[model samples]
Target: MVLLTLMAAVTIGIVRARNLFAVVVLSGIYSFLMASVMIVLDAVDVAMTEASVGAGMSMVLMLGVLYLTKVEEAVPSHTPWLPLFVAVGTAAVLLYGTVGLPPFGAAENIVHAHVAPRYLEQSIAETTVPNVVTSVLASYRGFDTLGETVVIFTAGFAVLLLLRGRRRSRPSDDA
Candidate 1:
């Protein structure tokens, strides 16, 4: 509950912040808080990934972009009512969608009843991996993991290309 409150506060801070740097820092804090929540939920692997990718690499990337841009966001000439309405609508829809989800950690949940047991019982024999989680991610869901890796790699490569283009477009001091 406390972690969720902190996460909500951080989210509010991020939304209310006009300073780009402060927003980035707050986003990192939010990511760290989310990682802590994941840890509390017994999702250490997810927590580690969230910390490293969300808090670590994302911060570094945003800071790099900030170095090349203004620290403060420009005030818009007009109120963003359409975007505000869209955001509220999306949130409402998402909340409505979650209403049908099984209670958290419920033993009779679909994953618990069908997926987890299969992984726990057959993981070692099928994958020769002692860790059930490892077997599930590496062997059972290898294609999914690979797809995620490809997406991340493509995004990083695109960012690098954009930064390179910006550098090339700038006038060199030595020239």
Candidate 2:
């Protein structure tokens, strides 16, 4: 409960901050808080990934980008009513979608009955990996991991391209 409140406060701070540097820092804090929540929920693997990727590497990348960009955010010329409405609507739809799902931590859930047992039993024979978690991530779900990597790579590449374009369009310092 304490972590959740801190996370909410950090999210509000991120949303309210006009300073880009502060936003970046707050985002990292939010990520760390989320990782802590994951740990409390007993998802240690997810927590580690969130801490390293979300709080660690992502913070470094955003900070480096900040050096090339404005420190403060510019005020928007128009209201964000459409975006706000869209976000609320999306949240409603997602919540509605989840209404039919089993309660959290229910051992009789579909994944527990079908998928998890298979992974525990067959992972070694199928993937030849000693560690079940490693086998599931590296072999059983290899394509999903690759897809996530590609998405991250694509986003980073897009940011680099945008930065390059902005640099090229600016007047040279030598002039």
Candidate 3:
């Protein structure tokens, strides 16, 4: 709970920051903290992913972007109240929606009743894999995993294409 509170504070700091570099650093810290939270929740695989992709690769990418751009954010021209009100309104609606959800970690949840048992009992036979984790990811969820990979590749390719074509301003150019 303490760690989660710290993460929220760091997130608020990230949002309030005017220095883009400081924002990037805080974002990395948030990812690392999130990874820690995942670990505490006993989702080590997800924690490892958060650490590597969220903290590691994202920081590298953000640093590369910062190298090519200004470190400070430009001031906004309009009042922020409208956006803030909208955000609070949306959050209230979402919270109200979750009020109908079953309590967390309840063993009688639908997933525990149906999907998990099937995976444990039949995953190896259907997928012909010795490891449950391997069979689940590479066979059961294979299409979804492949889709994620392709999407990531496409996004990276698009970013490279866009960055490659960026026109740097000349020192002699005058208004």
Candidate 4:
């Protein structure tokens, strides 16, 4: 409940903040809170990724964008009703789905009985890594991590391209 409240407040702050820096900071706060929620939900890997990418990398990129652009701008008018309706509808659907979820760590869950157990048991032998999650991320599913790295690289490259200044070449005197 507290995390939900924090997320709501951060969303409002991000929308209402006039200063770009304040908005960026609020966004970082939102990401951090979301990471905490993921941790509480027993998704440590997701939490780590969110903390690093959403909070750290995103804040750095936002700051770079702000540095490349003007600090102040005229406020644009936007109607919030459509977005509010969509958000509420999505939340309602998610809540409805949550009602059908098996209790966390229930033995009858296929997740625990089938997939997770194999990963837990075989990962050490397969990868010679003590941490099963790390082994899975780095060895068992390396291609996915490579793809993610490429995506982040692409994002950084795009940001650099956006911020790069174009120089005009002078016509040669001989020409």
Candidate 5:
């Protein structure tokens, strides 16, 4: 509960901050807070991922982006109320859409009866992994996880290449 509050506060801070550097730092802090929440929920694999990629690598990447750009955010030229209304409308629609979903953690959910039981029962026998998440993500969902990882790495690489190219293409003022 306290971690969730802190995350909300950090989010507000990020939104209110005009400095891009501060927003990036606060976003990293938010990721760490989310990782803590994941740990508290006993999702250690998710926590590790949030800490490593979300808090660690993402901050480093954003910081690198900061290095290549201005630290302060420019003032908006247009009024934000229209965009705010659109965002609120989207959120309301999404929330309404979720009303038909089963209550969270309900064992009666159809999907829970399927692979979850298998993961809980035979995962250890099949993968020798004591951790169900580890077995599920690394074994059962291995290809999916691998593909997602590849996509993330590829996106990061693309961002780096674009930033580097932009830098090199700029005319040197010192000349």
Candidate 6:
């Protein structure tokens, strides 16, 4: 409930902030809070990815864009009812789905009995890491990590290319 409230506030701030920097910072905060919620949900891998991509890389990219362009711009408001309707409808569906979920940490669920146990049992032997999550990410699912690294590198390269210089000011013709 608290997480949902924080998410809503951060989203509102991101939408309403006049300064680009403030919007970016608010988005980063939103990402961080989302990551925390993911942690609470026992989705550490997703949380890690979200933290790195959202709070870390995206914030840097936003800052770079802000440096290249002025931080403030005149914002025009438009009819927001369409988005409001969509958001409310989506939230309703999500709430409905949440009611069907197994209670947290229920041992009888298929997740604990089947999927998670295999990792807990085999990962130590397979990867020699006491932490199953680390072992899975670094060893078992290495290819996916490599792909994510490549994507991050590509994003950084693209940002660099896009922001590569023309002088911010033009010299006077008299000079």
Candidate 1 regions with alpha-carbon error over 4 angstroms: 166-175
Task: Give the Å error, residue 13, model 6.
Answer: 2.4
- What candidate 2 gets wrong by more than 4 Å, as runs, is 124-130, 143-175
As a whole number from 0 to 100, the lDDT of residue 54 in candidate 1 is: 99
* Alpha-carbon runs more than 4 Å astray in model 4: 42-46, 72-74, 104-107, 165-175
* CA displacement after TM-score superposition, residue 146 of candidate 1 (Å): 2.5
Ranking by TM-score: 1, 3, 5, 2, 4, 6
Model 5 spans > 4 angstroms off: 156-175
Q: Give the alpha carbon lDDT tens digit for every residue of 1-175 in model 6.
A: 6997999988988888888888888999999999999998888888999999889988987787687669996856888799989999999999999998898777787667766788899997888999888887888889998998999899878765754544344322110
Q: Candidates' TM-scores?
A: 0.86, 0.76, 0.85, 0.73, 0.82, 0.71
In angstroms, the error of model 2 at 60 is: 0.8
The sequence of per-residue lDDT tens digits that candidate 5 reaches over residues 107-146 is 6988778778888999889999998988888889999999
Clash count (model 2, backbone only): 0
- Decoy 5 TM-score against native: 0.82
Give me the candidate number with maximum lDDT: 1
**Candidate 4 per-residue lDDT over residues 82-104, each given as its tens digit:** 99899999999999999988887
Clashes by residue pair, model 6: none
- What lDDT would each prediction earn against the true structure? 0.88, 0.87, 0.86, 0.83, 0.88, 0.83
**Cα lDDT of model 4 overall?**
0.83
In model 5, residue pairs whose N, Cα or C atoms come closer than 3 Å (at least 3 residues apart or on different chains), thus clashing, are none
For all predictions, the C-alpha RMSD in Å is 3.2, 4.1, 4.4, 6.0, 3.8, 5.1
lDDT of 1 at 75: 88
Better of 3 and 6 by TM-score: 3
Encode model 1's per-residue lDDT on 1-175: one tens digit a residue.
8999999999999989999999999999999999999999988989999999999988997897787767999888999999999999999999999999889887778877767888989987788898777888888999999998999899878867766765666745210
The whole-model C-alpha lDDT of candidate 2 against the native structure comes to 0.87
Error of 4 at 27 (Å): 1.5
